[model samples]
Target: MKKLILPFLCIFLLVSCKNETKQGDSNSNELGTAVKDTVIVEVPKVPIEKTIKEIKEALTAKGFKTFEYVDETTKDTILMQQYFMAFLKRSAIKMQNEEESERLQKLHMEHLSKMHELGYADISGPFGDDGDISGVTIYNVPTLKMADSLAKSDPMVQAGRLEIEIHPWWAAKGIGLR
Candidate 1:
């Protein structure tokens, strides 16, 4: 029994190492020189200064602004034109009954249309019923207070059917339809 176990273990070890040895041998010629079949290309290194200059040039060419990294703690990195916007996060639980919900929806549409006409709203849409938040409305306002004021004017918010959380947001200046 001991002899049979030893032979089986030896056979397993030989089988496992057979493939690796064959692969290693194929990578070299009979003379032990790395064959032309296996090509090894080394990447050329560019100086740090030259690489940085090239990156900056590429960004400039593509109309992108570049800036140096500052210390941590704040996310203020690149200096792009900052625009104030508002995000209206609809509450997950509906406070209104069916009738109230329908009425407020109408009011909401009217209010959004008014915002669109005034060039204050960039985008607005519902987030589907499955999500924690009901919908999102992005407003192109000048200040957080202004965004809150505009949000408060919604009939749903006034009736306590929808909750509004006002936040100050900054984004790239020229985006979305004019």
Candidate 2:
């Protein structure tokens, strides 16, 4: 009985030792590579102001509404512009290369004409709806009245083909006009 007990203890110790070694090897294999922590930094934003005193004066002279100004600022104008240019380039490519989609180019040209007629110098990118692409235009016009009038009376706006949003320079910056 003593001899049998001694043999059983030795077998148990050997099996446990083998399992411990296997576990250690597995853990070391998992630790082969060192992990790195990444840090991201964000920069402060700067505001851009556009004064449309001339555009506003022109609108007022045309007997449009009284001028009220709303300032406009966007966090990522460059990104927005890039997106706009990409859309334009893609649309142009599609129009030139694809025969079945001429209407898109036509609608875009019409919208561009409407924007140009209003003396809008800045385009806020294109918004698409039901296969139609419409763009927002920003004018450095002088008065809110003129902006409102142009927004309301423009052919695109009247036909519900375009949307117009007016913001005074101060309003864009959340500041009050003096």
Candidate 3:
């Protein structure tokens, strides 16, 4: 009975150890080679000139006044914020009369409401003298189509109070959300 028990226990231990070793080996192999090889295909790059021309034409067709700047690689995010803030401050300063201030306030409220309806959070402008006058409000709408529609419909955007600069992803590096 003792001999039988010893042999059975040895067999069980041997089987368990073999199973554990097999599991470890199989796991390593799966980790190493589980990724299936995919065919690599290279896509031809679109000519920058052609792409820019197309975008310009589309913008023009959509009734947006387009300006083409040379590829100076200016820091856009910072520059955009500064430009927006300056514009807003100048506009606010021009509003000296109570009527003008009321108009501007109404416009601001309308702009904010429109942006909210379009499902976007407003991005505030860069630093400046007064928080209200110097800060510009920015929103990223659901789609380019929606943005274009909003631009056409919104008085602020149409009057150039809210300037929308469309950028390709490649050009938008290092620009943190406001």
- Taking all chains together, each candidate's TM-score versus the true structure is 0.48, 0.28, 0.30
lDDT of 1 by residue, 1-178 (tens): 9989999999999998775566666666665556666667987696434444565566466544444443367764433322334445556557678987898889989998898889777777777576545666776665566667887898877776677765555544433575
lDDT, candidate 2, at 90: 19
Q: Order candidates by lDDT, high to low.
A: 1, 3, 2
Candidate of highest lDDT: 1
Assess candidate 3 and give its TM-score to the true structure. 0.30
Q: For residues 1-178, what per-residue lDDT tens digits would candidate 2 score against the true structure?
A: 9999999999999999877666664334454533346457976586554445554455458543443433356442221111011121112232233443455446655755675665543443566653434455454455566556654554434444444555553223223346
Model 1 root mean square deviation, Cα atoms: 15.2
- Model 2 misplacement above 4 A: 1-108, 114-119, 128-134, 170-178
The lDDT for every candidate, in the order shown, is 0.65, 0.47, 0.47
> Model 2 scores what on Cα lDDT?
0.47
Q: What is the lDDT of residue 155 in candidate 3?
A: 52
